[model samples]
Target chain A: MNQEEIIAVQQYENALSRVDQSVDKITVLMSSAQSLAQQGTQIMNCFAQLKREQQAYEAQFKELKLKLQSDLIKFQNIVKGAEARLDRHLDYIDKWTNLLLTRDLGTMDSQELQYQRNIMDAIQMANDNFNKELDKLYSL
Target chain B: MGKNKQVQKSSLTDEDLYTMLSDNLVELNEIELFFNGFLQEANVIDESFGTVTNIFNGLSMGVLASMNKSDNEKINRAKAKIALGTFVVGQVAKGVGSFYSYVKTLDRANDILVLKKEKAATWLDSLHRNYDRVLRSEISSRKILTHLASLGYQIDELISNREVYDVKKNLMQMALEQYRKARFNVFSMEFFIAECKAWLKNKHDSNMQQPILQDVNNSIIQEVLFQGDDYEEVIAEFFLGSNEISGSILFVLNDEQLLSHYLSTRKDPLIISDGVENKHINKRVLAIFKDNPALEMSNEFYEIRKEIDEDGEKSRKIFWRLIVTGSLLSTLVSFFNLYLFCRLVMAIDDNTAILSVLAIAALLAFGGLYAKFEEIYKELKNKISKNRENYERYYRYEFALKGGFANRRKKVEEVVGKSFFDRVGKAISSLFDVGDSDDHSFYYEKLIEREYWNPFFVTVSIMLILAIILTKLNLFFVGSLVVLLFAYLKMRMRKKYFYILTFIVVLCVVFLFLYMKGVI
Candidate 1:
């Protein structure tokens, strides 16, 4: 292989590693959100107990509990969406790595080059979806 | 042959493909970093929710304790009285809190106005700089292009070196667009500052309605939301647009590689091709090149300004409502005190009914006057103290601005030699510092010096002297009338006569002290 091809291969490997690291980070975020959801559930349970004992403030407790429950559901959905997008991105990266490894850069046809560009575009789209989920989580 | 050329152009080489991949990698890395930063901020917000929950829990416990019932009638009546007292005190506390918040908001509004003025000056300087760097260069380039075209040079050949001509044209266009956006920002900020000033002035006017505050608040919220919408536009136009046409060009014009590339491509002579249509230099581009450019206002400033206005508006409304409620409650309490006085006089002597009634009337008058005086003194003291601090802050800001202008002028003289650029710098500096030269600092200093001689202090002293004299002379009703008249004058008098009123108050206090000591 030529020096340019070698450099291209090195860059591709670097990109794969970066994508892998991003996937790991997303997993950590999902777990943290899961714990937060559990905490929210516990707080809701405590509110329910308080409502039973303090009938005078039953309306306030019910309102708070409902809000917490809705927030927890929203948080779970965001985590699920983020996880799915991260998986899709990993799949795209895998396809990209396979394409690079199997084909010689100088010998690739127009169809193969188009397919490579398509894979990169898919990865970018997945990144955008993940970012949207993060924005949802932030709002929640 | 044309089809073959088109096919060749459509297909990318290995090197081009690798370059594209590298760019994508950089973009992915940026996205990842953004995600991490967002996650960290979200975590902090999540932690704050725990504190909120704890506060809610404590409040619920307190509510439960207050809900418990008692069996004994006397105990129940006492409990009811305690609850009523707590309610009244809570309302008064809320009023005081609101007043404090309103004062703080006014202070913040004044600070924001000073900041906006400073920012306006900075923007003016940046506008001058941009005019010299971007607009002048664009104008000269357009003139050169037009001159060359008129001399029969083919624009296609001239623009073939995209690195030299096209980049410069694009930069100018982008800069002009940014400047246009900046002009809109400045206008909006100035409008907000004007609203804030109006709100401050309205507070001093007792006749100002609540609706005016609401209107100002609504406008502030609309401005804030508008700014948020503008941010999305900026991200799309500025950042995304930069990415589309050589990302580093707009941010780093003086980069070594770009400069070298431009310098190397500058040697091409103007050439003409017959019947070739010009694509690079459109009419719109040329028009923008001729237009003036302004400075870009940062989004952070808009965010901070919005927060200040919104917070101020909320506090002002609270202060107005609660203070009125507290005043009504105080009047009710005064009536209750009169009822108590009548009961005591009846219990003292039932046989001498008319004498007892007269004595009760006199006692009631004295008690009502004392209560009214105390309320007035408390309110006036609070307001005067806050106003004093605000005036001091005003003086400090004026002093700082004056000092800043002097330093700026000295720096211009020291750093810049007597060249054309230096002269332009001096002229612009002087233009912005025109307000400073008008002796605003001197005016503020004089105001601060006279601030200590407040009208409220004078009113308090005069009330004290009247109370002591009338009590000794058995003229309670006359004293009450005099006190009422003084209160009316105190409300009506302008702040400018503070020194004169203070002198009168001091004189009265000295005279009263001597009389009490039997020296007068």
Candidate 2:
């Protein structure tokens, strides 16, 4: 080629190389963008999944809480029944004490007096056991 | 087997009989209610299944488009994976929805049973509270010896009341049954939800595992980058071509309305063949022209064009019918008049009478021809104006497409330009009628689809011809009137029909009254 043609050829080669470099750079940048977009989408989907799971968890928790409350009420009712029985026993003890105290222990036979005392003690023990059970139920 | 069949045939009192029947009925009703509710819930679940699958289908398609890379095999493999993933997701959702619905039904049944149990519990509590009082009140020396031989007298007081015990037992049994059913339903729901979550996670992980396009050096990536000048072109190319970067672009331009509108408006039948609903068209157009702010038309342009076409069509149809009917009637009248004139000249020898008859016939003929011509002129004027408006819309849309780049604009213009009106015009002109039919036929076609003319008008036209023939025969005046009545009724049942009917009735009543009064 002539000198002028040679200069043109050199310029064309330089331009071609620059264009090739630019293409490679663009490809890299575009690919990065694509990956970023994909990641962003995945992130969005993750958020959605998390939200749905959270909602389901909340529903389950509500059900569990209701169940716990129901069990508590049931335990309370059992405790109340035990307490009522204890109260009735206490009432019987008070009535018996009145009947025994009115008769005068001094005039009563020793054996009969001893028997009454033992009965009172047994009633007291039973009442204590009932109260203990009630307390356990309440704690539960 | 029924309870009655299982129960022994024992003699019972009226009260016991009533109680047993009611108890059995209530139990039967509960069972019936559960099955009915379950079946209804199943139907709702089935209905939602289609929707859930469709949602996943759309999602997978969207994901596929967004992850648009150049490799055909990779894209196809990704497509298959996405399809399978979506199917799994759909199945999971379907299962979950169905299980949840079943759970809800069981929960409802459980709720009713719980309420019954609570009622029974409250009653039992009341009984227990009064148990001591009842015992103290009822117990005599002899009663204590008979009942309270042990300290289980209080328990016997409740247990001895057979009715109360049976009712409470039934309530507890029902409640337990409901709880069991609900528990099973809940278990299934939990399983389905867990499976769904796992499938979702797996799908997500698999999606993440796909090799990211880190370099855009390939011809495919280059082609994608230079697909079109605008967002719409990018969207279209992703839908149409195998672009490796579709996923990225779709995610970036994540307007569901716009995407749907684009897909629907695409001319390729294989693409979204069903055009988006009318409501979405303007939004789609605006989205496509978002970058081109200088575009003259607003969204209102579509509404305005529709309104103009509708209003213009109504009047044009009226004008066309009037012109056609008037011309036909006028021509017939003129020919009849000319024939009469010729007959008078040939037969009648009285010069004055013939001249007068000729003069009258000429005047009548002239008047009819003038009216026909006037109507024709009016019809032409209306069609020309309507056609001009429709044609201008095409050009305005075309100009809007000429934005930053020629190729992109050309594509957009081609899309928006070849819209509903243009397509109808082209279809009609090519297939059916061309020359003088252009202006009227385009509007008429649109109008006809909205208005049922073929059945009503054709019937009326046929009846009118029959009526005219019957009248010509002079055989039945009442028959012709009946035919006319039938034709009138064939018109749409709108306010106008009522008004016309009322008008005719009033006219008939007036005529009848006047005749009765000897005033006419």
Model 2 stretches with alpha carbons more than 4 Å out? A1-140, B1-274, B278-298, B348-402, B405-520
Q: What TM-score does structure 1 among the candidates reach?
A: 0.20
Worst 10 residues of 1 chain B by lDDT: B268-277
Cα error, residue B21 of model 2, in Å, equals 94
Which candidate has the top score in TM-score? 1
lDDT of 1 by residue, A22-74 (tens): 66545434543454455566556644543443353334334544654565456
lDDT tens readout by residue for model 1, B1-520: 3423343344332233223322221112232233233334333333333333443343334333443643444433444444454344434433333333233323333333343333233233333332232232223223322221222222343234433333333322322222222222233223333333433443211122212111222222123212234422332243222212222222112222222222212221000000011333243222221221110111222243334444444444444443444334333443344445445643433333334333434444444455555565566456555554554444333333321111111111122224457545544443232212333343224344323323344545554655554444333443463466456446667765645765665676576546545587
Off by over 4 Å in 1: A1-140, B1-169, B173-299, B345-482, B489-520
* DockQ for each model: 0.01, 0.02
- Model 1 reaches an interface RMSD of 24.7
The TM-scores of all predictions, comma-separated, are: 0.20, 0.19
Checking candidate 1 for backbone clashes, the offending pairs are B154-B271, B154-B272
lDDT of 2 by residue, B1-520 (tens): 1322222122132233223322221122233344354446445544455466556656666556655653545444545565567667766665555444444443443444343343233334433433343223222111211211111112233334544433322222222222222222222223323322323332111111111111111111122223334645655554342313222242222322222223323343112211223332233322322332222232334444545556555655655565556545543554454456546645644455445444443444434344434544565565646564444444333322321111110111121123357544543442222322214332112221122223345446644753563245321322343344434444435767757865765676576546545587
Model 2, position B43: C-alpha lDDT score: 53
